[model samples]
Target chain A: MERTAFQIDARDNVATALTELAPGPVRLAGDGEAEQVEAVEPIPRGHKLAVKFIAEGADVVKYGVPIGVATADIMPGSWVHLHVMRSAYDERSAHLNLRTGAPEDTRYE
Target chain B: MSRKEIPSLEELRALRWRGYAREGGGIGVRNCVLVIYTVKCAEFVARGIVEGCQSPDVQLVGFDGCTDSQCAVNLLAGLIRHPNVGAVLAVGLGCEYVQPERLAEIAARAGKPARWLFIQNEGGTLPAVERGTAWARELLDELRNTPRVPMGLSDLTVGAECGGSDFTSGLAGNVAVGRFFDLLVDSGGTAIFEEIVEAVGLDWLLLSRAANDRARAELRHAYDKMIAYCRSVGQFSVSPGNFAGGLSTIEEKSMGAIAKSGSRPIQGVVKISVPPPEPGLWLLDSTPDPNPVQYGITNPNDSEGLMDLISCGAHVVLLVTGRGSVIGSPVAPCLKITGNAETFRRMSGDLDFDASPSLTGELRQDEVARLLAELIAETAAGKPTKAEALGHREFHIPYKYQEKEARRADCERR
Candidate 1:
């Protein structure tokens, strides 16, 4: 497949999206390139892009350690977010709610 | 890292300071009194005590939980010993998952005199609040009696990070942070950086910097898994802000963002909620999927991520900003350094330190390092950070999900 959007280092698994793309409608270049791979999620701008088919129940690699896992089956060019990649701490985690500067140490003090 | 050949105070004016920026260990800029809670039920009482206290150094921080034994155990164990806390006051409800006395015992073990207050046992909220307030006041007075002992710069650990990032983050703020990291490392002081997501496309560079083949391979495997998992759901990990800021690809962002490490060799990697086991140079495994439940949510912004390091015991934080960040952690001092000269000019009052000199080409690398080292020394002795002075306390407590399947996965990772 011809690399489109984000380019992946030959040594890395993740690709950076060069352009914003809708799920299941974009064409790309490479061995696994698809004209419209079913998008598991809406890929945000400047985030990681999948170069090939990634299985669910697997680790999400960025710098190489697992960031999170795929909650469901995804195709090429889908946007990934809270719905697909679930977090353990959803309610008090600062990542979900942008406001409220409460500290993560939830002990009562 | 060697101690200053000969120490002198006048170096403060010459921008040449003795006992500043030692190599290996990261130095702290502030010594804080951490007021902690042991469980959810005691939160209000703890807050009342903190609010009524007269000491400006005490910071209120805690966790929330009812009876989940495991959760309470983790929160209490982590918060009480977090490095940012110089003195600790652990509050709890008598019947909470974690006992307040147990927390006090733990703190006492660490050689920090811990005061305990139980809301339920102490005659409910009002009585507990009254007693806790009076006790905290006494503790503050006791803490003040301890003289400020001069410590070496190498005795400090300063965490470096950036969030709410823009394109300039890599070019300006992050780079400055890297420079500061390098200077600290050379001096035998420790400077740690995290945010694995920012390393999406820079695996090769990180692998090369890895201390051993195991870490190098681990680095590659970790990034690959993140990408695969993200792609499995058909969603891109990139954000719109990155595109708007003119980043064409994740690789571009990764390369720029990783530069904040300032050419330091990777010592080792640590998991979330884990403090750097040993100082030197450490790469905290900060890669988190966009999921709120699996990965932590408290660290949405870069400063928040830095706060994690602070919890692990960083005495100070070098917060780099390209756009602008006014927030700061309560326990530790945050030295806000801006890469964008325009942003620095506009938010001069909100900023504690400026690295705009690098952008102007007027200051060389060593000169900036010398200036930053001086700032670190002064702040360490006892100076209020920009965030503290402005009362910019931004807190976000992450909520743990109860999905059976997800919980299983989380358990496996742990």
Candidate 2:
């Protein structure tokens, strides 16, 4: 299949889904082992997916630096989001919704 | 990690453009005679001159304050001395604290022809408009003869700002701008990045990039002040809507937001209305002035951000938006770039360049960066940006209490 995800760096453990990715052979921008990671679940556009296995408590790198850490062990192609990962520096990450980008705690009058 | 494709100084210095050389040691891509209204009552008169003038280069800007907001005056003064502007026509009711002469004097001091009048002194609208229009037409005509000098990246000062961002913004648009900024700085040009409030949860990241110890101290002070301002205002820069675009955390979002600054060591922090003292990478802090009585909110909108960038003497401003933006500003031309291919296709008429090709791996980030820099060169050499070509010259100067010392940028209050 055509490439639908992008990885910023070779060290990046996650690749951003450029579109709504269904369970299939998802190809990343570059080629290599795990470059053709399978989508373990449906991932929304702009959300992240594990390009390789991410063990619990390990850094999830993007742009060649740690953006967050895996909350649980994540296999190749599994969606990487708030459920399975958390921000290393920002506590507010836990409240964000993946699809809408709206914080769960936001309230309006 | 694989090697990135950044353009070198040799490549940057190779390009050149013809620009209007300013008297005080700078250059202008445009040569417009700006009409400035000092008070709210004079707006119609000032705008009348802009409209009645035959030359399209006659631009209008104003402050609506009846009382003195040093911040407002400073910004107006900065605009008068902007490199894009060649002359000035200052109009007022003569009651506002922003003296019409004071504004016109700025243009004169910058070696540009300037004139001023008061609506009250002129006995009303028609007389002021007729006189002002005649002066503006003549100035714009004579400015057409402003000597054009050869300029390169070293003579340029470009400002970067982003809004309405999405995942593609960080991955493509901002990343490309960052790379472009790096090249601009390496080639002896000045690059100023705003929305410093967006650099949340990354004080270390910001401080680490400071070019010198003085810059480190300035960054610390600006960051602490911004954080304090955020706390007092009870707002962080992030919003619920940011998540809808796929930012996962404040740091995650900030990491993407700040990518436009590139990897150059930050020169130092400067305030609104204050141009960077020298050419380099500078971070503009838009936090409000610490006053006992705060009257207005910060960064009322994105147009204000672009205006602030202009007031600080950016020859052209690159506004990166993943979602997209159509607005522009007076004085300097605004270049809107986006990384969302769909948005680019939909708003191609308004957007200047599309960095979205990088997102699909069709183009490398640095390749897009070079292309964007080339666009800047073209715009500097008299090619109007989409915003300028579309005549989207919107501006805003709210009455905020900032010391004349110049706290720059348009960081939002909420």
Best by lDDT: 2
lDDT of 1 at B19: 26
Query: Per-residue lDDT of B318-363 in model 1, one digit per residue for the tens?
Result: 7777667788776667788776666778887777766656544556
Kindly list the per-residue Cα lDDT of model 2 for residues B9-47, writing each as its tens digit: 466578788889888667898889999999889999998
Instruction: Sort candidate 1 into its docking category.
Output: incorrect
Q: Among all windows of ten consecutive residues in candidate 2 chain B, which has the lowest summed lDDT? A: B405-414
Report the lDDT tens digits of candidate 2 across residue range A1-109. Answer: 2648888778788888888899998878743335577898988888888888899999887767777788899998888877888766556657677666566786885
Name model 1 segments beyond 4 Å from true: A1-109, B1-29, B39-41, B67-79, B82-84, B221-225, B228-239, B287-298, B399-414
Cα-based lDDT at residue B298, candidate 2 = 62
lDDT of each: 0.57, 0.82
DockQ of each: 0.04, 0.44
Evaluate model 2: give its TM-score. Answer: 0.88
Model 1 chain B: weakest 10-residue lDDT segment is B16-25
Estimated TM-score for each candidate: 0.68, 0.88
